[model samples]
Target chain A: MIVAQRKPFEEIMNMLKGYKKVLNVGCGTCVAVCLAGGEKEVTVLNTELDMARKLKDNPIKIDGITIERQCDREYLAELDSKVDDYEAVVSMACGVGVQFLAERFPQIPVYPMVDTSGLAANQAVGWYEERCRSCNQCVLGMTGGICPVTMCAKGIYNGPCGGTNNGSCEIDTEQPCAWFMIYERLERQGRLDNILELHAPVEWLDQTPRTLVQPGYKKVDPEDLV
Target chain B: MKSGSNLEKVLKAGHFAFTGELGPPRGTDAEEVRKKAAFLKGNVDAVNITDNQTAMVRMSSWAASLLIMQEGLEPNYQMVCRDRNRLAMQADILGASALGIRNMLCLSGDHQQFGDHPSAKGVFDIDSMQLIYMVKKMRDESKFLGGADIHEPPKMFIGAAANPFAEPFEWRVHRLAKKINAGVDFIQTQCIYNMDKFRKWVKQANDMGLTEKVYILAGVTPMKSIGMARYMKAKVPGMDVPDEIIKRLQGAGKGKVAAEGINIACEQIEEFKEMQGLAGVHLMAIEWEHKVPEIAEQAKVLPRPVIE
Candidate 1:
């Protein structure tokens, strides 16, 4: 999912301080499903920004477009005819989609309107909560489906710290102890002995400073690939 | 075989308030074939078969229109610019005419993001205004926009949309002028609820000498209940319902709101009866089509006048 949080309106207006003839380009894939970069959201955002700009004595000429997917070169090619009409583009997508739009419309300045958050799932209609941390090694099979890296505070390798007070993490009182969840999950699977296995001290090098390079089935050249 | 085949003639006849719609099967069930043609049969002048309603993959509108044709219902097949370029749009207009789908509604169509599938491609190579001019070019000159000759000339009744209640009301009238200038034969407006604003808009059109440019059907969708009214006002972008009607629904018991909403619409039709220069009403009671004949009778519009 394209998990994104809206940039504050003040922040967005700050970015487009001097620009007129802006295009509020939306990405229709992941960001759209999340309701951040869809046409409806773009319309609402455009209204808000226009109201803000008008209050500031700046009447900006803004038009909108929701391209199918900003990541694909073919889809981005759809903007070729209309790009010259705009001075800048505000892309309402993840960081990846923003970069892709920038690469496609190299002459036009593309600004990001969303902050890309960690991988998450919608808990229900409007709530999104983090569920998985791609730690490069998935040990959910051994741990009975509890994701210790994401759920456990301090990224507990083995057992809980003494800070667990009434099944709550010490990091924050409302936070549930991840190790406790792992223990309960293991108990349910009839493999309580699994918790005795001592894990080695771990480093989250790849997980931190995350950079994803998906190997190609892409038809275009690497130089041409956005 | 003559100009009677043209759209303006069919609309100016004025007795039947004709409308067209596109219904892609909600699922892949094959029985939807007979169901579609049967639903709209004889209910209106023609049923519109949509070309990829919302850009989701479905049975093509041509095949669906052909099915409706077999069911003996005239199909007003709609063509959109999102899926084709001008050349393809021109080709499809000829193709539709050959297939005996006479009435056409030219649309720019909704963006792909609004549909269930978002990763699909968008080809908005032309807007609705440009498509109208292109259709006129093919019809009047027997040639393509580039001056290329055609083997046979094609003629069609053309229509576009107008929504005075859409935000920034001034722009809506501006767009109306553009559509009339583009040679739209008639305008099937977005669902209208507020008659006061609508009357003002008609006055503006008349003041600008646009009252006679193209036949205008004040599009109306009668709500079945308070829930339906709320949903329509919420989801159907350009549709509006007045607070008094909302409060009327608020006062009327839920069990009888359908009849109440129908009565409210019937009242609107009664008031619309006095407006001069009207073609007819386009009642889009969506899914409640069975109530149409009753509502028309309640509004005293039944035993439709024989006008030509």
Candidate 2:
């Protein structure tokens, strides 16, 4: 799931403090499931703003609008007539949605209301823990389905490293050392001997690295992408 | 000044004031409601008598307000549009005026799904905005939002709610402005724990013209116990409890936590009272009734604002 944290209130306030007409736009895909932006959350925000403005002696005019998925242009196409109603749009979707909205409605400045944290999974109800860094590598197969690249503090490919003590990693006591989990899993599967074998070093991609590709068989799709 | 002008006086009071909430009983249990009103009197400026609070079936806000008034306490009647049409609301406004329940807080009411009766048909013929507009029309223009003339106009001090620390932060400020434009006279916010967030929201509200037109009351619910604190943070959708407060409450132990909770509440009230453009504080104690007095005392808010 796409994980995000709410933008600092001061930052958000500063960004929208100039506008009188505001549109709170919610996205119903990843941000919705993660509870960052949804119909319920949007309504909640609406109530808070309503109350705050009432105190300052300058009550504002606010409206709410939500789209199906902002990553796709087709969903945002529905906001055609509604965009002109407000002076500014407070986007509750991910960082992608904010950029898409900025590009689509260049006239009205779009501001992101949430800081896109990272990919994470729900730890429990209303609880989420960061799980992946989106390192653009898949080495879980060799590590018994437990990712060492993302889970390791040092990102050590073949390491218990001297920093490991007991079952925990050195950097954070909250985390279990990735190699320790791998060792236990291999022992349980009667594949402990594999630990002794040498494996080649990995070249991990950093940042949001993008790549283009061509098909080997039928390559006509290059023109279709445009 | 006439007692009828107390609403304006109450609003005019420097920010850091206190209000209380009273959820009316299931039936016409005047004894239970009177007992509650007695518990709240002299301790709070206005006691909010809920109208079908939690969306469960209960005594109406108008009756509850009159009953509380009979028990010698000012009542802020909570009205919801979930079960009433424009006609009932219009008539109900007249009925409330006849009973001398002048202070009313307007709401769209909780959805049926959230309450015990999920299958109960909702009668949201008009939302809170339309109802507020109608009330304004009757009182200000002797007409409703539709411009229809009314034989008996009603007088009310209208208030609404806000939830500032909700997850999707950006949308809340603008939505608040809409309610102010809808003609709300005052606003009572959702239970707030994150004061830092609230300060920022207030600035944003000021920018939106929300603070210019409406009086605001910051809502606060004291955590009576550590267990209750956990429940409020995790279960209460909009209540965002800081980790430090949780740790503090945890370290305070059982007997000490209640006192600690009350102390924290007092500190918040003290801060709220001094804020620029702040109107007041709305205290929702849930069932922890008697502690409100002690909290008010500790906060140094005594000789309460009387409708002199």
Candidate 3:
């Protein structure tokens, strides 16, 4: 799942400046699961903003609501009737949700309350870790399920840089060296030969900002759709 | 000489090859490069221009290297995989070669966490070993890493760094062998404050006959003071300075500490000359470039052999 963290309270409060009525919209999917943009977080942000405004002597009315998923137009349709009640929206979702809300509600300004970190998972409660780089090419099968692209500090496919010491990364001693982990795992699986063959450099050109076209589905122009 | 570089010529001719490091100034100052190169000239076979050593922003090593060449000194251009991708790396390699740089040292740079910009991303598109292979391919096979023919590939004498004191000590020699297999013609190690451990590593290299395959130059950095010694022991990662050395430095007393540090480095150099498979010494005086010639003379590496 995508991992994100809430913007600092002060930054969020600053974004709420000049707005008298604001809607705090939360997403129930990845951001919610990561505890970044969940309904619980929305309530906390709403309360903090109210308190901040009261302390500043410029109080504004803020309402909080959570949709099942912010990325889908069908789920966002539920907010159509009442979204006009607010002058602006504080989107507590990933980058995708904030853009979607902006596109759906053209009249209201949408602000992202959370910073999208990376594609990661909750390792433990209150702890999240990045797992996939979405490099568009997966090498897990060759590396014994270890994603060197994201785990390795340098993202070098064929290493354990010289700095790898005792299976730990040189950059951070707490984190395990991805290549060392791959070596040990590959050794255990008796596929150590996989690392011997040098892999070519990553195709960065192909990994640039790209759009995926759903196969066999008619692509409709957004203006023509409505 | 394979690359016709001065360092390569010195090593090939069986002379004790001495190299010094030139850390470019943080700003655009060609005079700093020339000033350091002038100090090292005639005292060392080649001067290594570091590429943003310790991750601090510095003048590019490429420009410094050319400046050193202008000073009539061969510059061993150092490269790190931390900043550039393979495309940029290969292009720089070709450019360096075209501009009279013949010795190339590949390094896995110090992480940016130690630098001014800790948030900057490190682009280690390929490891040092792979970098060695890529350069060798370009030089020997006359082809790019993608197998496209190069009209004139760079002819470089490949070099890489080895930190024998680093953890998994037993595997250090094996790692050296890996670099050798990747086409490293020479190896310069991390600073050696722990001579006993370095001896053990050299023994392993000798046993594996790695000495016969490539030239190994031991690294030496003279400690300026007891405080500096302690800082290196405690703060520097992969540095294994024995308590005895630290005590000796502390014993030097304020008036004679710098002299003691040079004496210690000279002793290491004397010992390295006798060690098996050891080619020579790479003196990295850090900010004390002025002392390089004296250190070399005291170690009796002066009057460098004039190769045919």
Candidate 4:
């Protein structure tokens, strides 16, 4: 799932500094699951802002609403009727939600309260490790399901760099070397030959800011293929 | 004929090559580089000019390399993927070659957290491996990364760092081989203290015939005190400091620790020379650059090879 964490409280306050009445919208999907910008987080932010504003003697009005998924246009439509009542909207969703909310209501100013980090999987309670880079071309099958593109510090397709020590990365001794894990996994699966195969240099330029259209669902643009 | 530097000639001639490290000053004092180069002038085949090693801001390696060249010492100019993107890196390579800087070492520098500016964003647009391949492409094919033609390409004897003590110890040799395949002409490994592990790694390289494919220079950092030994053992990443060596340093007491450190370094150098697939030693005396001559003399690499 997409992982995001809340901005610093000072930065959040600064974003809502000038606004007299603001609406804080939270996403119930990824952010909620990650305990970042969930419905509970929305209420907490609201209380903090209310108290902060009261202390400042500005006495600003703040409200919060949590949509099922801010990325979906249908879920965002629920806020359309009341969105105009607020001076500004603080989106506590991933980057997708902040931009989608802005596009849905162009008149109202939308700001992101949480910074979208990366695609991650929960390792333990309140702990998440990044697992994907969305490189468009996935090599998980070749690498024994480990994503070297996101795991390796260098993101080299071939093998580990000289920085691999003991099984950890040279960047930080605590972090495990991704290629080492890949090799071990492949060897355990009797597929160590995968390491012998050479991969061409990745074309990262063509893979970024990519848009995908599901066939038979969204209209496909022929020009996009070019 | 790439770079045609003295280090390249010595290694090509299969003479036990010796190189030293010169860390440029944090300030804009070119004399610091010259001073460090002077210490290593007659003792080493080449001297490496570090690029903000450990993520700390320092004088640019390209400028320092040019300065070291003026000191009559061939500079192995180092580049890190921490501050520069491919565009800047490509331009700097061309500029270094135009300025007669011969050798280049590519590295994915330490994270910014270790540096003065912890808030600084690391620009790892490409890793060191890709940087090597990119530079190799530009030099051999005379083409830019974007497939643009280069009228005159930079000719450099490329180098990269290896840490045999790093984990997944079984994969270290294969990792070195990967760098060699990526167009690294030579490799200078991380500071070595564990002779047993290094010998095993070198043996693995020899068995795979990777030793014949590329020159492997073992890195040696002479410890100054028992405190430095303890600090490296506890703090330094990828450093393998055996407890016995610590005991040896501790046994040396306060006054003799420096001399004891030199003895330990010399012992490692002796073992390194005998190790299969080892080409030479990259002496990183750190702030003790002046001790390099004495250390080199003791290591029996004093009469440095001179190549035209």
RMSD of each: 25.6, 25.0, 2.8, 3.3
What TM-score does prediction 1 earn? 0.55
Residue A68, model 2: Cα distance from true site in angstroms: 33
**What is the per-residue lDDT of model 1 for residues A66-174, given as tens digits with 9 covering 90 to 100?**
9888878788888889989989989998888899888777898989998888678888876787767677877788778877777764454543432333456644558
User: What lDDT does each candidate get?
Assistant: 0.70, 0.74, 0.87, 0.87
User: What digit string (tens of lDDT, one per residue) describes model 4 on residues B1-308?
Assistant: 77787889999988999999999999998877777787888999999989998889888998888898888888999998878988999999999999998899988787667788877877777878778889999999999988999999998999999988776687677777778888899999999988888888888889999999999999999989888999988777678999998999889876999999999999889988887788999999999999998999998887987766
- Candidate 1 docking: what grade? incorrect
lDDT score for residue A30 of model 3: 93
Interface RMSD of each: 28.5, 25.6, 2.6, 3.0
Look at candidate 1 and tell me the lDDT of residue A30: 79
**Which has the higher TM-score value, candidate number 2 or candidate number 3?**
3
lDDT of 1 by residue, B1-308 (tens): 22243234556665536453547565555457566556555555666666676567677776677777787666666777667866688878888778776667777665555567765665555566667777777777788866798777676777776777654354456567767777688777777788888988887887777867877777777777787778766555456677777889778785887888888877777766667655666666665545666766676655443334
In candidate 4, which residue pairs clash? A165-B166, A165-B167, A166-B166, A166-B167, A166-B168, A167-B167, A167-B168
- Candidate number with greatest TM-score: 4
Per-residue error for B6 in candidate 4, Å, reads 0.9
Pairs in clash, predicted candidate 1:
B7-B157, B21-B48
Docking category of candidate 3 = acceptable
Question: Which ten-residue region of model 3 chain B has the weakest summed lDDT?
Answer: B166-175
lDDT ranking, best first: 3, 4, 2, 1
Question: What is the C-alpha DockQ of each candidate?
Answer: 0.01, 0.01, 0.40, 0.39
